[model samples]
Target: MVTNKNKIPALRDRKAALLAFMPAFLMAAASAYVPMEAGLVLPVLGFTIMAVFFGLVVLWWQTETERQTLAMQLAGLEQEERVPTAPLVLRPPVIVGSPLSVLRELAVSASAQEVGAEIVLAPTERVQPARFPEPSLLPSMRRSSAEEVSRMRLVTQAFEADRIELHLQPVVSLPQGKIRFYEALARLRLADETLLSPSEFLPILECSGRASDFDRRVLIRSMAIARHLVARGSEAIVSVNLTAHSIAEPGFLWSLAGLFDTSPDLLGKIVLEMTQHSWRHLDADHRAALATLRERGVPFSLDRAADLRFDPEALADLGVRFMKLPADLLISVAEQSDGRYAGPELDVRDFASALRRQGIRLIAERVEEDEMVPKLCDLGVPLAQGFVFAAPRPIKPEIAGEQTASRPFGLEDAPTLLRRAG
Candidate 1:
């Protein structure tokens, strides 16, 4: 019975093999049906072709399986080793063993001292004792935490006090550094006249869940700036950076829409910007909010992208009109692979062309060095922003602080200062 079962399996395999070659057999027979010698040659050629095709397919399948297995193993290792390095208060203390060991050690020492026994216990194997953070270190840590909280409080107070400042950095055209756009940056002015950049206060705002408030303020200021530029007969657009937290907030779109209703011209003059991290982590609600804003004629711009891996079609569908990449990053990537390799499945050289096809413009930012200009131009990047051209300059407090302008901005009033920001 066992032999019959094994023979049945071999018969099934032979049947499948014959079925697979049936088309080739029929073709060979049809090619030379009259002479058996000629028919033999046709069959031999057909069988050889079929064998090579199947062999190549099998080899591809095997190699693909190996590649996938290795990739999965590597991913698993990376995930296992990954650590959180943000918001120090949230990070757990580094302890080799259970935290309870410290308490247990203290209890054992107390009991041993109470017993008044001078017994020396011999250790078979040398082992390190449990280490705990020092008492003095605790006060320093507390002070740091208190300072962080104080800074966060100061930022919150700044929002309430209307002490937020709006600064604009020019995003100019390549080859000719003509200003085309101004990226709106927020600064916090404390009571002591110290100006805190977004880098210093934004993290505090986000951690305190006040990012939405900040975004709203920046949007309002950016809209005013855009209007000012337009009223002066300048065709410059103002891009305002928004956080995901703001978009995800309830009634965020409603508020934004209301703001847009007040100034309809902002539709063409204002551009909404966000970091790549915020864009990737957006949920359905956040996307819906963005979609509502997009429907209202607000365009989006992606900034601070970690890599050059961008899907032009997808970004356009999401209403992304501009993408900003660092000039150094763009140059390094192009130099490394001759502009062929961009992330896993993109070409750096072809990226601008692809984006342009989708009505998206690439803006190379952080252009600190003058040498980066020709390289950026060669890469087909049309727009560039950084300290190489002009640092972020304040947009005159009277103009930015009020809806009505004191006077129109002239050529000198433009943020064209050639010096780097201090």
Candidate 2:
């Protein structure tokens, strides 16, 4: 609308006018120097060119004037209507060295020549965007840090007092719910006899570089339990959770190696478990340590697996005989993707098949509901562990301390032992 109302001198228009003027001026100059007969034609041509140029200029000026008058009338009518209006204040373009500068100068001149226009000027200030106090977690986070410190001190005290106890959670075969394995978890008994679960104290242990110590204690207890089970003729495997820190520590490995050498029989019944993160990020040294353990007949289980993604062949080669994932994760992955792989094109069912083919059994952990069992079974998941079967129970102190003739322990007697134990 503004462009139509304004007679802005365009480059093309200026060029056309310059061209017309050049021809007229040349014709007039030639007429002054030529003979009467030839001069007569030159003057006539010059006159005709001037007439056309004048007519074009008059027509353009008249059109622009009419447009300006109409715009002004519309503005007056709008003002009478009492509509709110903001003055269109044009800012001077920044003086940059280029063809743009020249264009800006021309525009500025044209705007200055514009008549009966009011432009309100505001102070030219660089607007700094609102600086919101950067999302602060510092105050609350510091308090959290202080709380963690206090917890760390308590956990340290517990470790020093040797109040740590071993708790076992059963991993059972789905549909049948037979206890196939028991995952050993360390529970710290505080001064007031408050038992701290792994979820509460494990992170503190890991952060304080005491994870290997906790894992070592857990491993020893698990081995002890495994021996008892094996001696009693039970085929139940006891899985001990180990950390990458323990795996990386030469001292821990040496101690484990010594254990393996002393009680070679315990190796078959004792399975070492590590999180998926630890398994995926195993360094060359970690792998060498793991390989050494594998050679000693100590099988590995991948615990707390975050996803369904797995290379069963690779894991099998790594001596990872068991892969424990959450039951909900399995169902969600299958249902959301319609049994298809969330990351790869392989089917969810095929993953279970592949794991089985590679001798890697898929055990869904945290199966806290009966409904999860059918979905897991449908997905070809072989085993599950959670409160749906049984909450984790502390091993009987007398059983752990038992040194007398081993009471004949077997798969059928497992539940009785669990019930009789803590």
Candidate 3:
């Protein structure tokens, strides 16, 4: 039976060889007949047919030999012993204590060393327990009462203390541009005559629920400074920050109208920076109050416009004329690609474009790097503010009028002077 199977494979190979030669045999026949019918020389036709027929037979034999060699190789592989593979070994994970436990152990060790020795307790001496002083009868320590007390204390002290002062930071225009405005930042002059930045105290004011009162005081002082600047033939706009509570107050619009009435000229020069967070807090009624102010020609700018959550569309609907984007946003974009602010790098491009379509001006706040100016300008941001442009400083007439006129505003100027005033 094995011999019969081998013979069957050999017969199959021979059949395949014959099939492969059939095309060559057909070509030889056509060549022989065509030459014979044309009455060509007998010897030439016979030699040509013979050469073709033999060439095909040789090709068929070579193919069959290759097939047989491959079959032998495959049969040998089938009979070969297989190599066993090694089993995979998985190592146990290392155990480690939590950071908090490690810290606690270290703290205990440190405390034990610092204490030097443990104390041995002796028998306690018998003595009468001293009567505690009667708890002072006062208002309960509820959040509302505590807040009211804190607010009263802050207002009282602020009014009594002469430390609170208004510091003006000049916000200069672009290259060879005029001094358009100065932002009025609140400064606290400590008892030592050292200046404390608004950042340190502004949070305390907000936490104490006294932001509105603080805003009122700042507005009053800033207006006084605005009047002073206007009297000097300076048409610089004075910008003031308003808290969300102040914006929501029903009488705030009226209060602003009264301020404008006192300093009529200040109306044209006053710019209120309504922060994105503050604007979000305003309900329908509060927004109506804002609309009333808008009708009165008080210009408003949306601060931190780069905040993704800040509704640019809504702010535009509210007639917001100016928007301030963070400086880092512009700077990072410029640094990444050929100092050009475009594509994904300019994330607020869509918002800026939307606002620009409505004729609103985009202001890039904190434009510290010099390289960023061209890119910002390219991005259609006409106004740039940062230490790179001009540091917030106490408004000196010469510095405000002349320094701004002579040197291009730079970020380097901000740290030296901004620390002095802001």
Tell me, by lDDT, which candidate is best: 1
**What's model 3's lDDT at 279?**
67
Per-residue lDDT of candidate 1, residues 1-422 (tens digit): 01121233112234445655565566567657655575587667767688657745544544555556567778988987795332212112234233365566656556655555344435664444434432311222233565566556555665666777788899999888899989888877654455787767666676567778888878887887887888899988988987655655567756887889888877868898887876765657667877888988998899889887767898898889999988888888888745654447667877788899999999999999888899999989999999999998988877775332122223223222122225
**TM-score order of candidates, top first:** 2, 1, 3
Report the CA-based lDDT of candidate 1 relative to the real structure.
0.71
TM-score result, candidate 3: 0.52
Residue-level lDDT for 294 in candidate 1: 91
**Root-mean-square deviation (CA) per prediction:** 25.9, 19.1, 23.3
- Count clashing pairs, candidate 2: 0
Evaluated at residue 189, the lDDT of candidate 1 is 67
Quote model 1's TM-score: 0.60
| C-alpha lDDT of residue 6 in model 2 | 50
TM values, all candidates? 0.60, 0.61, 0.52
> Worst 10-residue stretch by lDDT in candidate 3?
131-140
User: Across residues 29-104, which tens digit of lDDT does each residue of candidate 2 receive?
Assistant: 7668865685577668768677668757855765665567678889999888896444454554453333455567
Off by over 4 Å in 3: 1-159, 248-250, 306-313, 333-353, 395-422
